[model samples]
Target: MPESGSVELVWLFGPFAVYLVMLGVYYVWEGKREEQLRQRYEEAEHGQ
Candidate 1:
């Protein structure tokens, strides 16, 4: 019974940990994308 509980706990938190990692990756990707867009916009404005 204790082994079963331990396995269940790991199963539950394992997916949660994966989700947190994905969220962190997504957050970083978004920040980088925004920075790139801002730079492009500035370059376009300066070229005109």
Candidate 2:
């Protein structure tokens, strides 16, 4: 029931929106993982 112009808009921008969300999720996940690794490394280095 939508117009033809709007359909094109969705095709063009929908992937972009999804990509941005995925990029944000990846950034946050990597940040947390890196933090955990850094903490583990520091603990081991200073414990010796």
Candidate 3:
């Protein structure tokens, strides 16, 4: 069996690692969405 400390470390970091990955993805998605909206607004204004 593995040592007690090793198992504890995995359990602690596993969820944290997943959370960081998800946060990064969310941040990138929001940035792209915001950029798209800005471009559309600019196009509409210039067209008017």
Compared with the true structure, the alpha-carbon lDDT of candidate 3 equals 0.99
What TM-score would each prediction reach against the true structure? 0.83, 0.94, 0.86
Q: In model 1, which runs have C-alpha deviations exceeding 4 angstroms?
A: none
Local accuracy by lDDT, each model: 0.97, 1.00, 0.99
lDDT of 1 by residue, 4-45 (tens): 989999999999999999999999999999999999999999
Alpha carbon deviation, residue 28, candidate 1 (Å): 0.5
Output the TM-score of candidate 3.
0.86
Better of 1 and 2 by TM-score: 2
**Model 3 over residues 1-48: C-alpha lDDT tens digits?**
999999999999999999999999999999999999999999999999
What's model 1's TM-score?
A: 0.83
Candidate 2 lDDT, tens digit per residue, 9-30?
9999999999999999999999
User: Model 2: which residue pairs collide?
Assistant: none
Q: Candidate 1 or 3, higher TM-score?
A: 3
Order of the predicted models by lDDT, top scorer first: 2, 3, 1
